[model samples]
Structures are given as structure tokens and as C-alpha cells.
Target: MLAPESTRALFTGHSLGGTLSPMLALTLAGLGALKGEGLVYITVGASPGNKGFANIFAQTFPTSTSTCPETGYAVWSKNIINSRDIIPQAWCMKRILSPAQNVKNIPSIYGVPTIPFIEFVVFWLNANANKSHIMYAPLPITSCWASSLRRPLKTWLSFWVSHWGITMHFITMCWV
Candidate 1:
């Protein structure tokens, strides 16, 4: 191990990194690497680990009981899922209900018990996550998104340089 007084640890990741951030945080915390302080896990377009995995994480790291994530809010780890991203919707869950619904939805099966829920799922599927996932604008409904796309190549490069630096704040800006 490096010297305890050397440098504090911070973990940042995207996509899978976002998924692993919390797991690593939990592991490091258990190992006392955090030294009783909070470790920040920041992510962009984070796929939802909010199901069973999150439940287990909560049991171990229960300092904050807040499950609700606000847009553009930076706290623990910011799991920013584009409103249109289906990957984030396709959750990793241990609940039997998900699998049961899957089996029931098949043509061979009759009907799923949660017909309404399935309808909701179908509606979401119809929405097409891929189409909206690419378009982005900073939250608070500013012209950044549209204007960014319309900018000259020179201007666009400047924005990427300024906003695309390696930082969680920039990551959040990209998502929101």
C-alpha cells in the first residue's frame, strides 16, 4: 500500500465504470481505504444498479439512506441516465418478478400478471431509447444543446475542450 498520508482516493468511471464505482467504493470502504471518510463515485450515463445490487450496497454503506437522485445534483455518485437511454432502463435485478414477466411476455405464454406494468414496458420500448440517447443538452433547458450542434467546427471544438475534460462535473454536464 502507498503511504497513508500520500494522496486521497477518488474513483471515476463511465458506463461499466459507473457500475463498478460503487462496488469498488464498498470494497475500499470495507478495507478502510477511505479512512472513515466518504468516497465519491461519479459517473455519466450510469446504468441502474439501483435494484438488488443497490440494495446490497445500501446494507453495507448505509451512511445515507437517500435513494432519490435529483437532476444535476452532485453527491455520492451521480448516476446520470439520459431520459431516453434504454440500457439504463434494462435493469440488473435479482427479483423474480422481472424474469417471470419475461417468460410470460413470450408468445408461448398466455399473459403476464402485471399486464399494466408490461404495457408500460411496451410503451417505453416503443419510445426507442437509442434515438434519444445521442441528443443532449445541459439541463435547466438552455440553448446549449441545440446551439452546440449548430456551432461552427472551431466553436464546437472549444466546447469539447472546455467541457470534456476528465472530471465528474464535466461528466454530469454531458448527461444533463
Candidate 2:
């Protein structure tokens, strides 16, 4: 829908979209209808896995035969990530880029206030001996979940108490 003359620019999805926007720009150039100039991509809470895909995708674009116009194209890719957000903070795009590429990391605070809950989920499962090694048991698939729901209250209490002190600080970050 982006005609060369009529099209101003484009945008993509939240996390996955950030990684794919650059590739879309390259495709536009290959079609001969769009130049690389004035392309902009902004990703929030983006995933690091995209870095590997983007590096390989850019190489496939027509680099030799059709160089980006000398009009000084502006390909602005901005990634705004919350410090507590585990997904985007995990990977480094700079490590993947070759010497020729320039990518800057800008730190920002945005989105909801929430602790890293995954850690607690893991803790609860591990502390309960009955719950631990859940995969080892071969109970009827339907019965497994039903049995878990009926686990003794003491087991649940012990699991929470064991990790409560340790995870308190982790949970506070969600509020602070």
C-alpha cells in the first residue's frame, strides 16, 4: 500500500515488529518503488533474538547493484526498553554488528511496574517435593493437573515461606 511518491513511511509490531521493520525497508528498495531515505523504525521492549535475524536479512538486500541513494538516507531504529523487562535487556545487538555498522543503546524507563515473576514461579515448583520432577510421573494426563490442585496446604505454605524472604526484594522492584 506504500506507493513511492505517496508513502511517507511505515511502522511494525511491538517486540517482534521492532526487529522486522528494517527488513521491510530493504524490501521496499528492491521493488524499485521506494528509496531507503526517511525510513524509521521504533521498537519498545524488543527481543534480542531479532538481532541475529536482522544481520542476515540486511545482507540479502540489493547492496551492490542498487546502493542506497546518496541523498543521505535516514534509517532511524530506536529501541526503548524498561530496565526490569527481561526480554529486551537480555541480548546485545552491538555484539552482532560488524565493524561498519553503528548502533547505539539508549536506556529508558517505560511501561507497567512489575517484578520478575518468573523466578517466583520456578521457586514454588522446586520447593514442593511432590511438585518437583513433575515430568517424571506418568499419571493420566488429566489426573496430573487435578492432583496438583489438591496438594496439601502445608506444602504450599512451606514453598512460599522458604522463598518469601529471598524474593521480597525482587517483588519490591515491581512497586518501586
Candidate 3:
């Protein structure tokens, strides 16, 4: 149960848990356990739901600039996606095939060779598994490329420090 003085509830999860967090928030809001305006959810590497579910979620918890009644902070939900991570691309046919389709385009940091046959196999498998009729839509997202994070670490730290008062060490440790 939320304390009377608590004006916000932040729900967060990674990977599969990320997929469930938004659903959990929606369920709780529907059950009247939490107010939509007082809840915020942040998911990392979350899989996509069907288009209908995404639409309902967007409508139920629309991002707003309005501040919470009890707290001055803005009421919003954010999906954080690591651009290099494949898990976040699941259930969406185009996104699922993107890695294979663009394998040659991505720079290889480790000098790993890109095999054409393997790319084709991956594309074939994903194309067969994810059909066209079933559409999946992602929520509004804050995208960051994992490989490029180190270059922007200072800027990232400053943003987090200013907004959430988080320590640089904590943010660095989490990323590492």
C-alpha cells in the first residue's frame, strides 16, 4: 500500500520483467489501486505487445506535462531501449528482421566477421515466425546505443544528476 504522503509510484523492470511491468501498472490502475497520473513505469529491453494492447496502454496512461497533484514532478512513463539489444525487437516482424537485414551496415567493434548465410538463415527464421497480420507497436521510447555510451557517459551522468540527484558512481556501476 502507498503511504498518503507518497505522490508517485515508479515501476521498473528489465528483460522479461520489463515486459510485465507496464502490464502490471495498467492492471493496478484498472483495479483502482493506483491512479494513472500518479504512476510511472520504466522498462528496459521490453518485448512488444499486440497493437491493441499498446493502444489501450497509451490511452490509459498517456504521457503528460501536467504535474502530479501531491508532487510537482511530471506524470509520465518511459521505455528505455538499448539499440543494440535484440530482445526489445521481439514480436515485431520488421524489427525482428532488422538485425539480419542490416548486419553488414553495423560496424563490428570486435572484428567479428559477418557471414552472409547466417544472416539469411536468421532472416528466414524470424520472417517465418513473425507474421504480418499480427502487428505489434512499441510505446514511446528513449533509445541509446550501448556501444556509444562510454563516449556520452559524462553528459548522461550530468542529466541524471540534475534530474534524479543520482550519484555518478551509481550510474556508472549500473552501466558497467
Give the per-residue lDDT of model 3 (tens digit) for 53-147: 76777787776544553432333565666565434554455544333312233223112454354356446545555443555556656555555
> Which residue pairs collide in model 2, if any?
none
When sorted by TM-score, best at the front, the candidate numbers are 3, 1, 2
Report lDDT (CA) for all predictions.
Answer: 0.41, 0.37, 0.53
Q: In lDDT terms, which candidate is top?
A: 3
lDDT of 2 by residue, 98-135 (tens): 22221111121122232244334433433442232321
After superposition, candidate 3 runs with Cα above 4 Å error: 1-7, 64-76, 95-114, 131-133, 147-176
* Alpha carbon lDDT at 75, candidate 2: 27
Q: Best by TM-score, which number?
A: 3
lDDT assessment of candidate 1: 0.41
**TM-score for each prediction?**
0.40, 0.33, 0.56
Separately for all candidates shown, the number of backbone clashes (residues 3 or more apart, or on different chains) is 1, 0, 0
Candidate 1 local lDDT, residue 175: 51
**Better-scoring candidate (lDDT), 2 or 3:** 3
Q: Which of the two, 2 or 3, has more TM-score? A: 3
